[model samples]
Target: MKRTVLAIDIGSTKICALIAEIDDDNNAQIIGAGIAKAQGLRKGSITNIELASKSIKSALNDAKRVAGTELRSAIVTISGAYTKSLNSSGIVNIPNKEITLNEIQRVMHTSLYNANIPNEFEVLHALPYNFKVDDQDFIEDPLGMNAARLEVETHIITTQKSNLNNLRKAVKAAGVEVESVVLSGYASAIAVLNADEKELGAAVVDMGGNTSNIVIHSGHAIRYNDFLGVGSNHITNDLSMALHTPLHTADNVKITYGSLYAPSNDLIELPVIGDETSSHEVSLEVVHNVIYARVEETLMIIAQSIEKSGLKEHMGAGVVLTGGFTKIEGLRELAVAILDNMPVRLAKPTDVGGLFDTLRDPSYSGAVGLIKYLADGYTAYEIDVNRRMRHAGEESATHTGSLPEEAPKFEPIAPASSTPTSAAPTPPVKDEKIAESATMVNIGSNKPVQDDQPNPISKFWNWATQLF
Candidate 1:
């Protein structure tokens, strides 16, 4: 069967919407795409819901117009700014002594339930990285294997409830329902990392206009992730300040002349901030210095984060860099220098076909990765609270298969708390249809934050006019 998939990636500098067609083999062909200048956002958080919604709508409309179709659902990208991650393990006894998909799902759900998630945060992904069947460990997939007990080690990613709600509201206001939320860093990894990189361990850093997302993938899953507030836009700001040029001019200069390599004595002219008609000359050396300073600092921070993850030693494939900022000259050389001499490879989206020329850029990694994510069913075994309950009722009436006579009943251990935990109840008998598309896990509260502020765009233009 073939179906269409939509993905939206909201960034501080731009918002991108992509629509694609997925075939029987899970290959995605880009059918439509839209990009709009981002407003009402700072460092990946929504500052003004109205303006953010408008931006999202603009991108969505553009994509729909191109595809000649209307889309109402999308798998959106969320930033790592408010995300936190932890590792947890869950074990379940195999009653039939045969591991099936149901057992795999149960163990993953148990791992999520066992995690001590913060009350203010909600789970986004519970990715199983390792599995152990009885005494044998490092099992990738134990389905159909005979084992008395199964244990799984998972990496759980969560985000703040308030921020997630704000994101959902912005998308909803754009007339789209969020199918699933994937972390920006994780999405980038899925788009760029090769099988060798994933198996041998590697780190990916997606440097955007105003934020850089970092993810470390090893043993077939993400082991660590982090966020950096600094990005290529900071270089532009530094240039504007140091050269006394307009922000736009500084951005252009950064794109034209920015480099980390040894500087030349060439001279370049820049437009003055206030006096648009008057221009001034600046040394190329000076521009390179300013850009180098910011790039160095950003790379240093990324290297530090990798070190902090404690998984650096496992990174046999080293670091892979992508995103808009990675296009800068000499970044990979500098990354190797600053990132402890680990190998660094620059990457863009791969395995994408059909109208993908624009989508091939590193800048679109997050957006393209979202399409790949939905097509691949990265979290197929994840448990959803509402879906589980609904399936439970359905299974009780239709499930007629018998378990082994000697098999023991399986139950998830509750958390140690005075208040009852809200984790999903024990897994019900297998429901064949539900198992095919079980990818969502909605765990957060339903309270919506009020948007009572004035028009953010008007205020921004007002400030701009005053400044100019």
Candidate 2:
């Protein structure tokens, strides 16, 4: 069956909505998209629920109109400004002497429960970045393994409950339910980072209109996240103040003439503030100076954030820059210089089928990432508190001591290969005795494949590849 998914990204400058069709293979094909000028938001935080709701509604209406379908629920992006993160570890004994899904889930939950998150914050994502079984380290999937002890290290992301509540209220007022909330920085990282980058470690900076989101991805998950209240809009504001031009006119000038490198002596005409009939000429050098100052300061802070994360040494892949602010000319080169000579690359969402022309921009990375997150099942390892509560209720009613007959299967963390698979049927395991003694488990599959199963090693290898 085909599944329809909707993703919404609400930012300081704009609100975007995306609708896509997800295939059985978990590929997303964009069907429609909508963008509207953002209101009631400052520095990525909602200031007025009514105005924000209207903006969300406008974007949703446009997307629904283009797709010719009604969107009832959507995965939404939340700014990193309202989020915080930490790392935690949990260890448990395997009483059965064999690892299973239940043990994995329990270990993860233990880590979360031990975190002692503040009451004012709500957990958004709890990602397991490393696993250990007995004396073995870096065990990608411990399921079906003979182990007396299991350990897991996880990255926990939490958001301010007040801000989260306002975000949900805005979306609810827009007539759509929010299915999930993703950290804006993490979403951007998901949309752009590649397999190698994720494994080697990389920092992603999403420079939006009024805020910049910084996230560090290492060991297959986000290890740290930080936010800056300044962004591209600050440059525009500086131009308006320095040149005495209207805000809109200054923005136009910045887009047309802004650059950190190759500042020219040429002059450009600008409309004076509050005087439509009056115009003034400003030196291109002045415009460049204003933009340079803001960009420099922003990049400097981002560099400091990376250093502050204490994971800078692990960022072998360097920094990946995305978002609308990154579109400024010469930004990547400047980033390299400011980021301690680290490799810097500007990125956008990876290409997809259907109406994806407009969605290709860096500004849409968070929106596009929402669909990818949903299709990829990136939260397979996350502990669902509500589900656990329901299970507890059922257990109390039935007074049962046994585990559930069917456990939720783990999905692969890595992106799927583009190469097509052969039509030949997979051969069954040959050694029944050995298979029962030591079953080889692949995280991507619904069930554990025996050790003698075809390509068992390859399946495990693929599972080791983390999500980018």
Error of 2 at 445 (Å): 30
lDDT of 2 by residue, 1-468 (tens): 679999999887999999999887677888988899999888888899999999999999999999999978988888887687888987766655778666665677677767869999998888877889988887766768998778988888888999989999999999999877888888888888898898899998889999989888886767888989988889989999999998988899888887789888998888888886899888998988889989999999998888889999999999999998988999989989888899999999877668468888998888887888767735335543121311212222122223333222221222236223421122112222221112123212433445566465566767777532
Q: Pick the candidate with the highest TM-score.
A: 1
Model 1 regions more than 4 Å off:
377-468
lDDT of 2 at 238: 94
Q: Which segments of candidate 2 are over 4 A away from where they belong?
A: 377-380, 384-468
The digit string of per-residue lDDT tens for model 1 on 1-468 reads: 778988999987999999999887777888999999998899988889999999999999999999988988888998899888899988766655778666676676667767899999987777777889999998976878998778988888899999989999999999998877888988899899998999999999999999999999887877888999989999999999999999989999988887888999999888888998999999999999999999999999998899999999999999999999998999999999998899999999876878567888999989988888767735334443112311112222123233211112232222233224433332233432222112112112112223554344545766787899
lDDT of 2 at 147: 80
RMSD after CA superposition, every candidate: 17.7, 13.8
Q: How far is candidate 1 from the true structure (C-alpha RMSD, Å)?
A: 17.7
Q: What is the lDDT of residue 56 in candidate 2?
A: 96
